[model samples]
Target: MTTIVHNWSMIASGLLTTLVISVTAYAGALVLGSLLAVCRVSPLPPLRLLAATWVTVATNVPVLCSMILLGLGIPRLGVHITLLWAAVVAVVFSGSGYVCEAVRSGINTVSKGQVEAARALGMPFGLIVRAVVLPQALAQAIQPLVNILIACLIGSSLAAAIGVPELTNVTRALNNQSGEAVLMFLLSGLVYLAIAYLATRVGSLLERRLTRSQGAAR
Candidate 1:
């Protein structure tokens, strides 16, 4: 109790770091993944090759190795970055690979008629995606994206290895300082579970709202 009270601020700092990394990583992953997902379906062979190669490389490589290479080695090539940024790179890279696949799967479910209708209406490719395709794909894939977010949250803990001082790192430090191992772990676990729960609930609500809107339209 005493140690927890004394070290609360330190723990909070770590939690804040974790939150920052997770949110940035999730956002970056969504944008990168969505683009790659689109590319994976593009007509151009070169674009398809680029998207395929990116997904393969990102998925195959160990995230830690990717982090070290991008965060540390890239600096030698004049791309200086902090550890947090490094973790962001790794998370987004890995996350986008998974998300690209998921988004592509969702895209596959879109009817050919829908795209044909959009083209017949003289809608540009970009406008069609913004007004129709993205919304549909996102509706179908939101659950998987939320699940990926959960995985990314857990993975962010690994950033502590490179000295990011996220929630897990603070827990470790507090554990060593206080010797209240069980309670400390329980607290940290609950925090993680709470975060995951909130994300899941938000995704579920969005899905339900979309379903209802579709029903209303019909």
Candidate 2:
């Protein structure tokens, strides 16, 4: 307890670091994942194969292994990315596979009739995807997308393995220094719980809003 009180600043900094990594990684996942989703549904065979291969590789590789490779292997090849950025890159690439699948599931839920109608209207492929597919697909995708974000939050702890001073790392240090493993871990868990609760609440609000908009459209 005394250690916790004295080291509040360190713990807070760790929490902030965890949040930064999770948020950045999730943002990158969304961008890359969205592109992959598009590729999976594209008319071209080569693009579909490329996207599928990326997702398969990213999904199959363990995050720790990927993190080690990103943090150490890349630098050995002459790239100079920091440990933090390396962790972010690993997370982004790894999470993108799940994101792509989730988005593709949403896209599948969109009515084929609407897509056909758009095509009948002579809309270009790009226009039809943007105007007809993405909106409803995104609405359907929201829950799964939020779940992935939560996974990202928990997975950010893996960054500690690569020497990032994230929450788990801070908690480990506190435990080592004070032998207050129980208290330090309890506090660390509480921070994660609080962040997860907020994220869930935000996701729920957005889901409800999207649902209402979809209903109004009908």
Candidate 3:
């Protein structure tokens, strides 16, 4: 306990790093994935192909391999990025594939009639998607999207491999210094649990609010 109490700042910083990575990565995944999902359902064949190829390749690549490639491979090209951003890019690229799938599935749930009505009213494709498709699709995909975000949070631990000093990495360091492996790991696990619990609560609140808005509209 003295070790934990004394080294609390290190542990807290590690947890903060994990959280920052998770948030930034998840936001990037959502934006990129939404665009990819739109392209997947686009009228243009080339756009569809481009988006589909990205999803296929990103999903197939191992997360660690992606991180390694981004971390090491890009440096050889004379473009330098930090180990942390490399991890963020890898996570966004990988997680976007799953996020795209979830969002596309949600888009499918939307009524064809509504889209047709929007088209009949002379709404452009972009406007139709923005006004009619995305809102409903987002509501439908909320749960799955939350799951992906949670997975991203857990996956962010992989950043430790590249020396990110995130929760897992710092916990390993703490364990080495304190020689209390079990205690260090237990504390790390609790931090992860707290993050996950907070995420679930936020997700539930969002879900309830969306439900209420939908009910009010009807």
Candidate 4:
């Protein structure tokens, strides 16, 4: 309909915002998640307990509840977060737990002898983690991490519930005002598909690069 044509730009803008939220959240999750995973595997009981608490708390809380708390509660604390930031933080918190577990599982797949070999060569813990352990573990974890990224893409939609004006929100607005429900939803679906396709492609590329390096070393 003419209304759909007239408001196409708004829909596009919303989709772009959604994309940014997902990508930023994915990056933040990776860093925080790596730290959590390390703590979970640490020998110190206190550290492991703290890490497990993070996993349990994050997994138990729904994204909607977390977003409402962050988006609403932060302003009262004089640390006002824009909807964009609130949604980003919530998604990171939601996905980071899963990412941490995946990384731990990947690390488990790595043989202990690799660390022993690194230590036998007088390699420091930092170098062993950076040059030996992390590389292999990341390679093994690529698939599950990609799955987390996909979850992020879907979770980004939750921002709309918090009035973040993400893709679905814009679609709803456009459809309600213009009665072009089918067109707006179709466009929104395509945007999601594009994001999913890109995530999958990047995962495949990383897998290939890691595999090639692994083969070269062997």
Candidate 5:
């Protein structure tokens, strides 16, 4: 208790850092993942193959391994990547794969008849996707996307291994200094639980609003 009180500022800073990284990484993942999802469903065989390969490799590789490669290996090759950006890139890379899968699944759920009708009307592929497919798919993808956001938040803690000083890293340092490992970890866990709960609630609210809007549109 005393330890946490004394280190409140540090803990708050670390929490803020964690949020920044998670949100940034999740945003990047959404953009990259959406592109990947499009490619995965592209008419071009090569594009589909490339996107599939990326999803396979990125999903299979551990986030820590990616981090180490970006943070340590790249620097040895004479290219500079700060630990912060390395962490962000690594999370974005891995998270993008999951996001791609979620979006692809949502895309799959879109009615094939609608697509066929759009094609029959001579709509270009891009216009059909943008005007007829993506909006509906994205609505269905909300929960999965939210889950990815939460995963990004948890995964941000791994950045501590590369010395990013996120919440878990700060907690670890405090534990080492105060020797109150139980209390320190417990406090951090509670914070995480709270944040995750809020994320879930927000997802639910958004899902309900979309559902109501869709129902009314029908």
Candidate 6:
């Protein structure tokens, strides 16, 4: 308790770093994932194949492995990469695969009849996707995407291995210094739990609002 109080600033800094990394990575993942979802559903076979390969490789690779490869390997190749950005990119790369699949599942849930009707009405593919498909698909995808966001938050801890000094990293350092591993880890866990719970509540609220809106539109 004394140690935590004394190191409050460090904890706060670490928490901020964790939030920044998670939010940045999740944002990147959302954009990339949405594109991948579109590519998976594209008429172009090559695009579909490429997206499929990306999803397969990204999803199968461990987050730590990706981080090590990007954080260390890229630097060795004569390219400058900050540890922060490396962690963000690694998390984004891994998280995007799950986000893509979640969105693709949402896309699948959209009614084929509606798509056919749009086509019959002479709507271009892009227009149909934008005006009709995506809105509905995104509504269904909110929960899954929220789940991925929480996953990203937890996965941010792995950045510690690459010396990113996120929450877990700072907590470990504090433990090493103060010899209060249990208290340090417990506090860190509580912080994570609190953030995750808040995210879940927000996601639920958004899901309900979207559901009500969709119901009323029907």
lDDT of 2 by residue, 1-218 (tens): 88988999999899999999999999999889988998999999999999999999988998888889989899999999999998888889889999999999999999999999999999999998888887778789988898889888898999999899999999999999999888989988988888888888999999999889879988
RMSD of 5: 1.0
> Can you tell me which runs of candidate 3 are displaced by over 4 Å?
none
| The 10-residue segment with the lowest total lDDT in model 3 | 190-199
Stretches of candidate 6 off by over 4 Å are none
What residue runs in model 5 are displaced by over 4 Å at the alpha carbon? Answer: none
Clashing pairs in 6: none
lDDT of 3 by residue, 1-218 (tens): 89889998988898899988899999999999999999999999999999999999988998889888888889999999999999899999999999999999999999999999999999999999999998899899988999889989998999999889999999999889989999999988888888888888998999999999989999
Q: How do the residues 125-168 of candidate 6 rate in per-residue lDDT, one tens digit apiece?
A: 99988898888888899989999999999989999999999999
TM-score of each: 0.94, 0.96, 0.97, 0.93, 0.97, 0.97
- CA lDDT, candidate 3, residue 75: 94
> What local lDDT does model 6 show for residue 86?
91
Query: Model 4 over residues 1-218: C-alpha lDDT tens digits?
Result: 67767877887799889989999999999888877887887768998999899999988899888998899888999997898999999999989898889888887888999889989999987677778767677789998999999999999998998899989999898888878788888888888988898899999998999889889989
User: What overall lDDT, based on C-alpha atoms, would model 2 receive against the true structure?
Assistant: 0.91
Better of 1 and 4 by TM-score: 1
Error of 3 at 179 (Å): 1.3
In candidate 5, what are the lDDT values of residues 1-218, reduced to their tens digit? Answer: 99999999999999999999999999999999988999999999999999999999989999999989999899999999998889899999999999999999999999999999999999999999889888888889999999999999999999999999899999999999999999999999999999999999999999999999989989
Better of 2 and 6 by lDDT: 6
Model 4 global lDDT (CA atoms, 0 to 1): 0.88
Residue 116 Cα positional deviation in candidate 3, in Å, after optimal superposition: 0.6
lDDT-based ranking: 6, 5, 3, 2, 1, 4
Candidate scoring better on TM-score of 3 and 4? 3
